[model samples]
Target: MNKTFKIYAVIFIIIMVILALFEVNKKEVTDWRKNFDVNQKSPFGLFVFNKEAKDLFKNNLTKIDVAPYDYYTDKNKKPHNILILESEIDPESWNKILDEVSKGSDAMIIANRLPKNISDTIGFYGSKISYENENVLKLTDKKYQNDFIKLDKFPSGRGFSYIKPNVQILGKTVEENNEDQANFIKAPFGKGKIYVHCEPLFLTNYYLLQSGNVKYAQSVFSYLSDRETLWFVESNTKESSSLLRFILSNPALKYAWWVFLGGLVLFIFFNVKRKQRIVPIIEPLKNTSADFVKSIGNLYLQEGDFHDMMAKKAQYFLNKVRLDLLIDTQNLDEEFAKRLQLKTGKSAEMVNEAIVLIKKAQDPYASVMKEDLARINSLLDEILK
Candidate 1:
């Protein structure tokens, strides 16, 4: 390799090495995605909640992957209190769930937002709220009114925008300047009750790890009936979907993935440049025909052969007209000038002057001057220009 190539290779290797070292020693960032998966130990995952779920339900916790419609329709399974922690349920499944709820099976849904069908059915609609500073959250009951839990800064959750008279407010989070917004509610269907809690983030591993937050979570669970707690697990597993997904979900692995891609690109670039055969520089072939013509033209100009040059120019012009205009050049008459004028879009006078010069040059005894030659050349140029 040349010195320049060697220098570039060394710089590239140094850059790659520095990047690798930096990435390897970099502090791992916290994953804050609200995956809400029981298996995920991320900040917004339900790993901690799922871990302590057995104890909370007295070892009677059961996870169901099937839809509420299919699960409820099963003849073998009896009515059990359901627990759902997801973004939203399908409308069909939700309707079936409501039917099960009406059949005296209690359910507690924890999500950021309720589906439009659910919201319309319950006669309440909620909006998302993000607090930049700490806020107070408490149950609406007289017993827990004074038990205010401090929500951390930059906490985002959902709250009711409109609540009907029948929907009983269970709990609320109050921001510094705003009124208490209902985040929890108890809506009756028939004989059973569906407790809708908007803030699923409050029950995640991050909040559960905090002091007094587990107690708050426990308090929220206190409203549920003490029966076989059926935890509804959605069929679509997001985190464990693929290896690439798992890598991207993790901060350290994501950084390593990008580093691997960078290294691969560098390796391809350097390896291809080193191993690939050098392309030979082939110069373009010189145009000798045009050069020969230019040499002959200069020789003629130096020889003072104005008559010969004029004859050659007129003959060349007539030959070009025969090939380009596809007109016969045997007769240089009035009709010929008119036809030439029409074909070349030149004035009739100009065409006639060119023909006259061409006819004069063709005569064996006619003498050609420099100005006459130049005049014919200019007339031909004007016609073909």
Candidate 2:
């Protein structure tokens, strides 16, 4: 890979490593949203409640993931107490739940608010009470009225603002001003009862982790009849809408996600570096024939060997004529000059002069000079052209 790309890849890795370390070491912010997922350990989740469900139900709790309508539609399934948390029941599910409750199956719904249909059908409008300071939660029964628990934080919710006479108030939020707002209620349907509580926060991990809040949850369950409890564990919450949220909701999965991303980046870096290496440039070999010939010419000129140089030049010309023009140069006669002039398209005079110079240079007794060499070279060049 090129130097610029390697530098960018290294910077990306360093940034990812820094992010991983920061995420691993930073103090985790508490999520206060009332998601109430059974497996989540967030403050508003139900992990603690789910873990303590067996104790609350006397080892009779069974988790169901389907809608209440589907769960009750099964003929083979026996009637059980239905427990719903942090959900708004649809009309179909509510009708099915009502049918089950009328047929002797109790259902307890705990949420911050209830749907309009359910609220109208149950004869209560779910409400909230915002207190600027912390409050106490307790059962409204004479036996547990004084057994109130102090909330570490101000409660963000209350209960029904209005209820029909048929719905009996079971619990209330005692504010600092002694204003008791009903947060829990029960209504009977046929042979079974339907318990509705507005403040679902009381049963979340945050509240349940408190020293005495488990007792409050037990008290809430006490309002339901003793039976096999089917806890509806829903996976359609906002937190479960995307895989990213699911991964981030769990510490182990979140860590693994970051690690997988880092590994993927590293794999790309090494793989590209291995496959996209720098390619070296190769230069073509140079032609040195001209330089070698020039050096030999200089040496002959320095040695004053004009006769030998002229003879060799004339022989080279004859060989070139035999190879290129298919002409025999064994004799420098007038017939040879005419044939050479016709073949080379040169003047008869230049061809004849070149032939005469070649014969004189080739003669052993004739003396050759630099002037004769220059004249033969000029005549030969003209004839060849």
Candidate 3:
């Protein structure tokens, strides 16, 4: 009975330890998960929420699904309504859409700046004014005050001043300090409307938490609720279209001669170096002086020119001594005596006599006595000392 009780106690302890380890592993798995309330009505899931916004989209709104830009460009899917949100829109992009709209393409563009080319394409029409500011207006009935929050006052460099003359102004602009200025506008183009907002923060999650932004957001969406709107929220990264890439690649075709020349130069440099061969090594022979002497000796022996050879050898030795010993060659006898006397502490008269013997032996073909050569060699030894 005691053994049974011990076995049961051990089983219970193991079960408790296993449960503790499982709990620890479970916590580790989901450590990075965050707990926050998500707003279903906002495009950005975790932004401002208001009772009016939730109710406005309760029955009428449907989330639009569309392919990527490249896919859509290839597919040529016709959208009845379009909404674009970007930090800034250049004249080129704005003009392209405007031209499409003018050709009866029903689309609405929402961007920070409505370039002049686009505004001109779409004749401006006045719309509902916002009492918040006389210049601010509502192109659509969509309003969400809770989502629009004012950020700290920072200069918004310069705002777009040129819009299409015929483009209608929908939002009213509130007069503020020149630095803190902000405005919004809308214009009709064919069957669609273009809404331009000055501040991009009005749509971001960070600014949408403001008290009145939610109402503004609701109003914007409500106005476009009637159409099959295609909301195109621009990605942080700009996408290059195939047409733009082709244009850049074939710059000569586009009359960009400079670009074509630049590409050609770069191509030449890369290809030219690749086609070249490796340089070969030509090793220099060692013992240069020995090789030179051997060649001279062979020439002298073969030509039987002992007299000229001895004369050249004597001249070579003399030149080497004068230059290496730093003695004047014009008055070599006197200069050698003085230098030898100073360098080797030898008598000047002995050094002078040695130089005289070497100078007199200029004609190597003459019967020169061996004793004279021996005497000169002895003197050379003493001078070297």
What lDDT tens digits, residue by residue, belong to model 1 across residues 183-277?
A: 88998888888898887777788888887776677778888887888888864343357899889967768877886787678768876877859
- The better-scoring model by lDDT among 2 and 3 is 2
In angstroms, the error of model 1 at 65 is 3.0
Q: Could you give me the TM-score of model 1 versus the true structure?
A: 0.61
Relative to the unseen true structure, what is the C-alpha lDDT of residue 54 in candidate 1, on a scale of 0 to 100? 87
Candidate 3: stretches off by over 4 Å? 1-75, 103-106, 124-186, 198-201, 225-235, 238-293, 303-385
Write model 2 residue lDDT over 1-385, tens digit each, in one string.
6786677678777876787787778897877776777777888788887788899899988887777777667654556798888765667888988888888888898877777887887778757566546877789888776556666664675767898999999888877765688888998878788898877778788888888677777877887768788887755333446889879967767886877787678768766876866789999887799899999999998999999999998988999899988888887788888889889898777777888899998998889989999999887777666
Candidate 2 displacement at residue 275 in angstroms: 12
Candidate 1 vs candidate 3: the TM-score winner is 1
Cα lDDT tens digits for candidate 3, 1-385: 4564566457656755665566556542221111112332333333343223335455433333332343244345444455564424444545555655555445545444455445455543222222232122233223333233344332132234545665544443333533223245556666556656654444545436655656666655554535454443344323456676666644244434444465467556655765668789998879989999899778867886544544554566567667776655566655556775676677877777766766666654465454655566566666666
> RMSD to native for every prediction?
16.0, 13.4, 19.9
* Model 1 bad stretches (over 4 Å): 1-16, 73-76, 128-132, 235-238, 241-243, 249-253, 265-385
After superposition, the stretches of candidate 2 with alpha carbons farther than 4 Å from their true spots are: 1-6, 74-79, 126-128, 236-385
Question: What TM-score, computed on C-alpha atoms, does each candidate reach?
Answer: 0.61, 0.62, 0.37
Q: Which residue pairs overlap in candidate 1's backbone?
A: none
Better of 1 and 2 by TM-score: 2
